[model samples]
Target: MESWLYILCICLILGAAIGFMAGLLGIGGGLIAVPALLHILPQVGVSAEKIPHVAIATSLAAIILTSLSSARAHHKRANIPWPLFKSMLPGFVLGALCSGYISEMIAAKSLQQIFAVFVILMAAQMAFPFKAQSNRDMPSAAHLFIAATVIAVIAALMGIGGGVLLVPFLTWCGLQMRFAVGFSAATGLLIALFGSIGYTLAGWDAAGLPDWTLGYIYLPALVGIVSTSMLMAPIGAKAATTLPTAKLKKIFALFLTLVGLKLVFA
Candidate 1:
């Protein structure tokens, strides 16, 4: 009982930090959430071997709510390009579903190794922001479909919002940064919804999941992290007024690099 309470506290603190960073950096909360959960879940009695899978699954599930709220806000501002969003929707959903099935078949250690590599790559991207020189317009339907499918699959596997990649891609293609951010927010919701469902269905009959888990998603961890992060995001946004965006992003990049190292060595 004491240990559970302790775990809950840690999760809350972790969520708060993640939320603040998301708001400040405009990065997806999953950027921090996945790594934090990778550490926190095991302390709460999740098996060491299954920790990576559980962390990723739970992170994706939590993002469903976070993304919905975010996308709604962006939509209210008319930031989302409905046509572009629609073009990508079907492919994203299909890829997420396929990735969910694939995740279940993967070995635990292998998944963690993959996640570690992804984390380092994301950190590098964050530290050194992409400046795409291309000014091409949005691609045609067939091209968009294929592109979205690839992005969604990779995102589902990495347990991240497609925003990390989508935002830069859109900007390179001549979309304004603001619109790209908004579009990324909307697309993230679709990815999370389908990916979460995939994980749930894929692990439906799996053995050895802890109590309070729905398939691979751990309920207690999700509840704690999502609730706190959602509450803290606006706080972080408000606080960012006092700091430089570039500095904050650099700090976040350093943090990710450290987390990536930890995961790789552990």
Candidate 2:
């Protein structure tokens, strides 16, 4: 036996690093975690045929915990925009729930390619950093619903918290960065929660699943990642002020690009 214990060790290391980077760079850990899990899960005996769906579901499960913590902290600050949050919930929930089923329908290779593309796009956004304002208030309820739905679907598909899309959209709608971030944190909770559940349901009766899996969500990986990410997020936040994020972001972005390419062609 190759000792599945190494999987836990790998998860802890991945979690700790992600927590530090999240704190250090303010990016969601999912972007990193999805790729990391894809690499690590096989060590624990997950089949390559199921790796993509498994990675995504497990990442979303991890996000449920992380996003909840972030949402709570942001909520304490009283910065979350409740009205917007309320309006978007219907669409967000719907999209997230559908993601698991949708993912199950797709091939693992296709999913990996999508994730790879998504990762590259996210890296580009973060690394390059662009902001444009339309000088308008939030859109109509219908528009908001539609936009939220799109974002939520993608977030579920990518196993991310949707902050990459949400934060910028909120900021563009005239919300300050701080408020936008807080709002996005709250929203991430919704995405993670429903998204993970959908995955669980989607994978409930899956074939050849590992011993500790709940649908596509890998239990050991989730435990290790959630435990460490929570502990390190604050540390990352503290270090953010002192780090040369500009340079770091560029380097990390390049790294993500390579990772994305590897996933696509691997």
Candidate 3:
């Protein structure tokens, strides 16, 4: 097959898979897309050294679209917490701005390594079913502020949608998994919106970026990913409602473990 054709096909498949997984996992889709893009982008002409930054930036950009779609769908289900959303936005904005600057300073490989370790740890935590929930009776405004701060810090540092932290935190705050997932998707949308803007503006002065690139994001990848992920994520969300999540958690953990090792050694 021609290289362009092959790349096109792979990009489409990745978009569908990431979208589906995002809906199923209530993640920002960055965790999956970043790692996969790191592997795939080089073949499509991006320099290997820049692939990780591009992956992270583009994943964030794509999430803006995918998360909006996912959140809207979940909104119809009445799963998002509007009060909490209001409380968190301010912190998210600050964190995103700071993180974008930090991202521009870091090497792509370093970011990938850091993210891999974080994923492995988070996966391990998820696999174990902690059975502990955070206290929620406290003032809603206070907790929302705290949660948003934590999310912004993590999202910027980890270069992931805030969903990974938000979902678990919300679940710990006593929301059911389904509601937590939906709300987290909504939060992810917010993070993406602010984070992408921050990264783009911060990296505006960055040099040697490609034609399809904006700051750190690669436009082609964003379009390919967002379009397909939006269409397919609901499928994953539907399956998540009916599936044995514990088993899926175990599998996802194993996958992350392997990917972490591969990234570390590569």
TM-score ranking from best candidate downward: 2, 1, 3
Error of 3 at 73 (Å): 3.0
Top candidate when judged by TM-score against the true structure: 2
Model 2: lDDT of residue 85: 65
What TM-score does each of the candidates earn?
0.93, 0.96, 0.84
Residue by residue across 15-47, what tens digits does model 2's lDDT show? Answer: 999999998998998999999989888777788
Question: What's the number of clashes in each of the models?
Answer: 0, 2, 0
| Better-scoring candidate (lDDT), 1 or 2 | 2
Q: How close is candidate 2 to the true structure, as a TM-score?
A: 0.96
Q: What is the lDDT of residue 196 in candidate 2?
A: 92
What range of 10 consecutive residues in model 1 has the weakest lDDT sum? 1-10
- Candidate 2 overall Cα lDDT vs. reference? 0.88
Reference-based TM-score, model 1:
0.93
Q: Which candidate, 2 or 3, has the higher lDDT?
A: 2
Ranking by lDDT: 2, 1, 3
| Every model: Cα RMSD to truth | 1.7, 1.4, 3.0
Task: Tell me which residue pairs clash in candidate 3.
Answer: none
